[model samples]
Target: MMNYHKRFHARMLFALATMAFPAMASAQDIAATTAPASQPQPGDENLVYEIAEVAGIVKVASIGMDPIKDAAAWRQVVPGESLGRGQQIRTTFRSKLKLVARPADPPTVILLENSSRMTIEDLAIRNGAAVSRLGLGYGAIRAGVAEGGVRSDMQIATPRAVLSKRGTDIFRVEYMNGRFNMSLSEQGRGLLQAIQLQLSNRGDVIGMKSRFVTPGQQVTHRMAQAIESMTFDRDININDIFGLVGNDKLFTMLNDRGFGFLLPFNGASNNIFNGQGITQGEDGVAPFNNGLFNTQSQGVRSITDGNFGVGQGSLPNLFDIFRNRDTQPAGSKKSMNEAMRSIFKPKARPRLNIGRVRR
Candidate 1:
């Protein structure tokens, strides 16, 4: 009887130990699994931009050290996709793209027009400020920055010049061939500076010259020439600037964000449908008065009537037509399909096509 009781007690002790051992191990495993969650993750402090909307055809490529070699493969972009440093985005004819910065406070919006190629050179939070640098190969982009509370240093670099801004501002940059243009909207309350680089015979930067561009002003520079600053002849129209007259979705998104002041209405005061319809007393009426009805009517007529007036010797006007078109060529559609398909295909080394390299 004693032996039997002793044996039973021994068995119970072993069973309890066995169960407790596993419980102890599980607690350790749980602790190990969750330890990293409290640590800062890699790239957590980096600034990232998400594709809010995409119209027509747009593509993105992962750029490496050698742009020519790494940029050979491109895939179609979709909305909600995130773009980080070392990425390049381009739009085809009749295409437009919208990007909204992550950590959306102090909103930053970027709009890429048709036939534009832009590369994200750097996007990181450094020294307590969000720093961003964009390289524009050829095309137009409109960027709006509202420093809700954080400090921001944003720059758009072109072949000819670099446009830099600190704090809140709405600006547009266009580059073609060797010409560059940058303009600050009427509502821009921040400072904008244009820096032109002087290069040596070996294509090395020797010096830089910078000038401040005030609100409601524009700066233009041509290769081997001085920069020209001028005031806008008339009230700029946001619809015309972004080719967004018919794009109700994008127009509403921007307008609701109080970006209407970027371009003010220009029409007769007596016109019943004045700019008031859009401004809505946000920043008060535009400095220049204009009838919203007339502006929109002209935009619609230009698109529906197919009267782009491209042959009128205005390169910007020609690009505007391409940006505002509702339809793309059949070839573009086919290529877009192929690009999307390539994403799922097996990895194959890209063949280098040495045509005009945009970088």
Candidate 2:
């Protein structure tokens, strides 16, 4: 009899690897052969921007480290026009951000200049559509808890597509063949537009390949051109692309390693929220959000029951051996019963015993 438990684990790994293989294999296909960040191409411009909002009287800070460590810093970034479309840009604090203590650089504050509030509903739509396009139905796990959390912290990217988020704002950041499209909520859109304008004024031409819109567009060239013209006036790095869009190469490499990577495209590192959902245990199915160990055990027992092994035969019990650890005394009735039972038990005998019976 083969060990079913071992087989099950093997199958699960095969499934995970099989699913991840294409994503990793595809990473190699999208490699970029370019000079290091130190050297800029003919028209390459360094740019940076930060998205923040104001609430009540004080400024709640949200900022993170520079995504690119050695990349040039935008010491002289120019600000663009404030997104003043009547509605009050409530740069209110949405949630507390996760921070790591660093010795070299201390934490910075996040300032809300003119930004809007983004909702979860807006992002759910685009995530659903994107999964649908990949021919994958929205399962409980889609945007739900992954092996790590309630959702995959993964920011999927293709030559023409990107799905990422900051805080509650999920942005469908896309750029295909020089066309750019960004899908976010009203608040997210306003912030993105502001950042785009800031980058354009700085002579950053990358935004021309992108646009910030809500999801559901069939993707058009006109929209791409319009996005391309939306520039920033700051020194932008390869890392700052996230505020408006993302660089395809950076996304692919991160996906290959099966780790979550989100960066502050703008200067407001405090605003960059990168929690990869909820974490279950090593079981991958166990979640930390609602239930604990007992819940996980019950779920496991349900899956590995009677039908999982041989029919009619019980599963092997490790504790059974310990049941007879303290043997009965020599003359005890229990010992006699055990000894007699073994002796009288039918042994494996030949099917036919004929010998001298005929005599």
Residues 211-262, candidate 2, lDDT per residue (tens digit)?
3334233233355445555665444334322121122323532554232233
Off by over 4 Å in 1: 1-44, 64-72, 222-359
Off by over 4 Å in 2: 1-152, 169-182, 186-224, 227-359
As a TM-score, model 1 comes out at 0.49
Task: lDDT for model 1, please.
Answer: 0.64
Q: Rate the local accuracy (lDDT) of all candidates.
A: 0.64, 0.28
lDDT of 1 by residue, 1-359 (tens): 96566556644544454365442212222222222212223554767899999999888986433335655587789999999877788898999999999877558999999999888876766666776778888999999998676677677778767777755478999999878888899999876777665554644444445667788988787422453223334444443432222344235535654545544436333334334434332234322224543344554322333334432334754464445333546557665555545544677767687777666
- In TM-score terms, which candidate is top? 1
Q: How many residue pairs clash in each candidate?
A: 3, 44
